[model samples]
Target: MDVHVVSKTDNNTHATFSLPTPTSPLAGPSSLRIRPSLLSLTSNNLTYALLGNQLKWWDAYPVPSNAPTPYNDASAWGIVPAWGFGTVLESTIESIAPGTKLWGYWPASGHVVDLALKHEPDEPSTHWIEVSPHRQTLLALYNRYLISTSDDETRHAWEASVRPVWQCAYVLSAYVFTPDPASNPAIHPYPGIPSVKETWTSADADLSRAVVISLAASSKTARAVAHNFTLRPTSGGPLGLLQVTSAPGPIQSAATALKPHFATRAVDYTSLDTEEVAQWIAALKPAKILVIDFGSRDGGFEAAHKLVSQDEVLAKAEFVTVNIGYQQKVYTMSDVGAALASAAEHSKIQFNTSPVIEAILPVQGATKLFAGLEKAWDHWLENREAAAPDLQLVWGEGVVGEKGIEGAWTRLTRGEVKPEEALVFRI
Candidate 1:
């Protein structure tokens, strides 16, 4: 399951990703006991960790105060397995065959299965039911709940289809993006005055501005977030349009569907002479940018910085940067990214770079929340459109299921899940 190790299963993988592991909490590998019969998934549940495992890295316990980075100066550290997620639309699910495609797990592997309802009070409303599981699960724990005309019928349907993986990016955005600066109920303040847009749209400020989702063409979460965004129109302005890619050849039809207000501005970043992103940002003055920057080194931080420093494009609006997080290596990567992202409202030093972490709800202490996420996933599925309680944990893994990409000891070091090379056939 880790990047360095190989599995005996047919899923020969070579993919690499970051992981979070805390030095404290309990160090090193855990011996998991299998109990697949206990697995159940529901559309109603929402919070969950992989198979009842605490999915984050390091001692990301309730922040004693609001200290954002304790690992900033550590020479070496341990990492824990992290996770990623994608949206599994009914249509997309219906269209693709098993093993044909996969969305990132916000950074965790929990997305490998789908969610279902359970009677266990301590568990998430839903749990996993693997029809053709890649790895035989032992003591699997799932979260998320769904509504069916008949409970039995719904249960049957859940058993049939593959459970959706980790947290969907759009759903995660909805949860993490605290659009309203005025209403950001912080145990400790994040600094600066609230923004006008966030203040007016406090209840929906996070929902107010239309997000310009990158990698829109293929990403399930990108498309899902777009769908979710369109359903909830905010006053932030017409959902702005911007798409950038490196893949070549004829444009796919998905590009055209995103038209008019939803403009798909495509370009090849590989051949650019100088930080060419400035032109793109200037052309479409995005209010607050939410990007799904996979494949790249630093959430496009290098390119964006080049543009902002050399060109005047990024100066016009309040810019919020979300990393492909798949690129996150250090604690500062995510910490600073969120700092700059929420900077407009929180007002700190104008950092030209950083990743964002917007928790969907107020989470309990890390351990407790991880302990009871399967039911939480159920609660989430029931109200996909609704915002859950907002807990404040400023760690990198806090958003969606992305925290799964940590090291062996905790997320702090350098360990991670290695996707099966076989997935390349589908990705």
Candidate 2:
């Protein structure tokens, strides 16, 4: 079996190594021996490594004891987890039989792994939670897995690539900036997490009278957010949308295709004319302006923010900036430190999906919430090709060598992957 390992101190330093697969008996009772069959690679995966220690992502998968030389050191090397589908090779639980497919988080490796799981009570039998002691540190969102019933490999690949990020987009649009506040109360940006003191009031979430500016608008999560925006009722808010991205043509085309209730405009990051953008916002007569920085390029977010601060009419409106994602690049230790410090200085409302989902589950029962999400997810899957006309899935095989996960990781480190290409591996 093969697995990928990355330097804990530097994400760019990574390699694949072979390790003997665990034999016969599983690790613990109710545990299943599984191997990741399909997985995805995205800039978000890079964020997992950059904030691994702070967020406990590194704890999800430890390097095997039999790994080669330096890679064997848990303190120095770790396996980054990816969202995808895995098949059970062996199981001890009577309810879960071998060959059953599961969808959730898994190490970006082909090696068989053991996970202790418990059926989530009061939910569908298909819903299970990872009860492994080492995984307890992870958020509920990461530990939750769903038994997949779909046999369409194409849909499975698309889901592996988009579902994880798209869920964040759904929660952001539906709950965070709730359209029907009566049914879905506006949730704080850091809902259920007391450590973060930032408070998001209902007024702040009211997008009805606001012009939303999305930085890094070409990002998968940003694209999904834009798509979800189209689903909002005309009276719900968000008077207009201004998308700033490197590739504006595709985004503009998608907006045109979606026919959102509000006006939409797409502009290149390098060609953002603040005067023109200010005029666009002023014409809308918005009472507030929400800028969502989805980890734009170096000066992209700063430039977009300048438009709001410099314009007299726009400056008077309520200005709110939500930090959702980071740029697609490998981060050094110092870079990670600076990012945390910068987020603190800017008073940015950090959007986390885990706590938000946890807060929503009790209010909107798991069954209902997932049903609504599945409906929307199915819609997105059907129209994804039209929505992202330029985007295409690039599939690879196995864990090592070129045309595999290792090569994909190398390209990610160099920031060579294009925004339109989705990388998935058949491990």
Task: Evaluate model 1: give its lDDT.
Answer: 0.29
lDDT of 2 by residue, 327-376 (tens): 89987667668777866766667899998888888898888778778888
Question: Once superposed on the true structure, which residue ranges of model 2 sit more than 4 Å away at CA?
Answer: 192-197
List per-prediction Cα lDDT, in the order shown: 0.29, 0.86
Clashes of each: 119, 2
What's the true lDDT of residue 320 in model 2? 77
Error of 1 at 374 (Å): 15
Residue-level lDDT of model 1, residues 198-293, one tens digit each, is 322343334344435354222223333433333333443334544443331212233443233344444454422344445655566655554444
Error of 1 at 208 (Å): 5.4
Worst ten-residue run, lDDT, model 2?
192-201
Off by over 4 Å in 1: 1-166, 178-227, 234-238, 248-252, 258-261, 271-280, 289-292, 295-299, 327-427
Error of 1 at 64 (Å): 36
**TM-score of model 1 (CA atoms):** 0.39
lDDT value, residue 25 of candidate 1: 26
